[model samples]
Target: MQRDALSLSQYIVYRNGVPAGARGGLRNMFHRAFGAATFAGFWRHWNPIFGYVLGRYIYSPLQRVVPRPLALILTFVVCGAVHDLVTMAVRGAPAFFFVPWFVLLGTGVVLGRAVGLDLSGRPWVARAAANLAYVLACLAITLAGECFIW
Candidate 1:
């Protein structure tokens, strides 16, 4: 069976689940992501544009061959590689920040899901703080790993 593909605009609207007038603005994205009650939900809300492409082209395909968790990690690593590539081009030097960072975040998602970690019962402020803490902790760990590597 053939699947119907949505245009980027439609995908953004569908992914964000926002009214057409809202257009998934940056502020809305930030609110949804940071306020998400689960790490997976945060990813679902983060950067709908990139998520659409990665979900459709990378993770979906890989999941058919590998396990879902592996696919998720690979998708994140691919995204980080793309970001690193752009940073390298602009800086005229190699950069290796995003890959490990994304890997840790992806792992967090998988483990968090495995543990049934959900903050939905918490206040919105608490949920947002937890999500932000997860992100910053990943960044700090990645920086430490990079320091060891260099």
Candidate 2:
């Protein structure tokens, strides 16, 4: 209750000091379909908790109708589309790399989650690997944006 501090809704949950609401650890609901780690991390990392709406409202329901793989793909597609629209609006031109960027992320989510689910008796490896993969994915997307987004 400090001054200038606003309270978060009860829906907000924390994981390892990071704000990844609603049981978003390695075994959280998001991990099952979205990926074991970092997929939801995009929003979770942001302090305002923007990812909450996307994961809870959009992602949750989408998973019910679509196949798991398709749901996974859709998740990134939604993310990409939103980003693309934002880029178009702000920059007044379509950078358009977000589609492929998010697609690549969806691929990483599937592969990383599969591997992370069972790290051959070493969970830390999966965590570290996932973190590394997320970092690399971000770097790749950023580089692509720099080159393509004019």
Candidate 3:
């Protein structure tokens, strides 16, 4: 990715500084990219300024008390709320999409983590299957939002 001029480092999610692709190791580049589809990864990775503040002050502390799934949901909720606040300042009307989008994203991240955890300690094929399922699940969430939430 960095070599191909296609890397989105901050947009990519990391746990303990390891890239999701490095951990998943999908031989196919397409699989690798989508397999790493995560809202927290995107929100926490993109833009160092907000990323550091969010990661250090908000997200990290939340994870201490909450499980990974709950932590992910809370993270997205906070993100959604922040986006809503920012948009509301301009329009001052209830948003129909922003909050729901983050909720859907929270769902995606929780489900993806669940699938990934289930595949842990399994063989390579299981890992690959988990990765595929996770990406498909994220895709489903985004598409479903466009159809129904929009």
TM-score of 3: 0.51
lDDT leaderboard ranking: 1, 2, 3
Q: Across residues 84-137, which tens digit of lDDT does each residue of candidate 2 receive?
A: 999999999866667677777777667656664443343644755765567587
Per-model TM-score, in order, reads 0.90, 0.58, 0.51
Residues 99-125 of candidate 3: C-alpha lDDT, one tens digit per residue: 666677678666655665443355655
Provide the overall lDDT of each model, using Cα atoms, as 2-decimal numbers: 0.88, 0.57, 0.55
Report the CA-based lDDT of candidate 1 relative to the real structure: 0.88
Pairs that collide in candidate 1 are: none
Clashing pairs in 2: 13-21
